[model samples]
Target: MVRVIMGVKGTGKTKQMIDLINSAVHSEHGNVVCIERGGKLTYDIHSKIRLVESSNYDMGTFEFMKGFISGLYAGNYDITHVFIDSLTKIVNADVTDHTLEEFLDWLNSFSEKNNIKFTVTISADRELASEGVQKYF
Candidate 1:
């Protein structure tokens, strides 16, 4: 239930995420959310989809982002999909950091348990990421 979009900067990773958001919003019966670092995605995601700016809250670490996501799911049970754009940018963590690695491991199980799909975009290529995290992409 967890997917990742990985690439270097300016590789159209966000565009791919936008496509997923727009398409999912049109077909999903439940709510869809796309979380970004700022207001850059306001005009990109579909109007029906909920676009949350991560900078609005106190999020800058893997733990905070994880709890933020958990809180979001708790606040709304109807959410079926969550698209996270530029996770490293929002959380200020290196892609290869162990913190992110553990967080991604948690996300995989969390999404499965909640029956919610998660898609995250990271600004790192496969070679740059650790072997354990490459499978996500």
Candidate 2:
């Protein structure tokens, strides 16, 4: 399943995502991963969950970010949940409704295929989000 935590910047989205990740770590059986734009939150997240800082790599496009996620799934078959703190920032794009829909469609399919749940934080108002993406919020 794909879920979104939508809100503007400095609205405590990261804290919410961290809380979800920590909860999953204790409640879920499989592995959990958290991907962020930087390493600032590394120490804040539970040590059990894998925290990845994408700023260390060149993930400047949606395709690149998708490939990076695919790589994670390939490397670890046990990953059950993935929490992305800054989806737009990681993709380095001004995601419009069209782009958001396309990305969500692909992500939904990928989540189903891999049997992994994805919870992402998108910096936008609930009404501004695409209908497809808003359903996950």
Best model per lDDT: 1
Task: Find the 10 residues in a row with the least total lDDT in model 1.
Answer: 125-134
| TM-score per candidate, chains pooled | 0.96, 0.93
Local accuracy of candidate 2 as per-residue lDDT tens digits, 1-137: 99989888788988888788889988878999988887877888889998888878877788887899999999999999998888888887554647777887899999999899999998876667767777777
Name the runs in model 1 displaced over 4 angstroms: none
Model 2, residue 9: C-alpha shift (Å): 1.9
Could you give candidate 1's per-residue lDDT for residues 23-44 as a string of tens digits?
9987888999989987988987
Q: For this target, which candidate reaches the highest TM-score against the unseen true structure?
A: 1
User: Candidate 1: which pairs clash?
Assistant: none
Residue-level error in angstroms, candidate 2, position 109: 0.7
Model 1 has an lDDT value of: 0.88
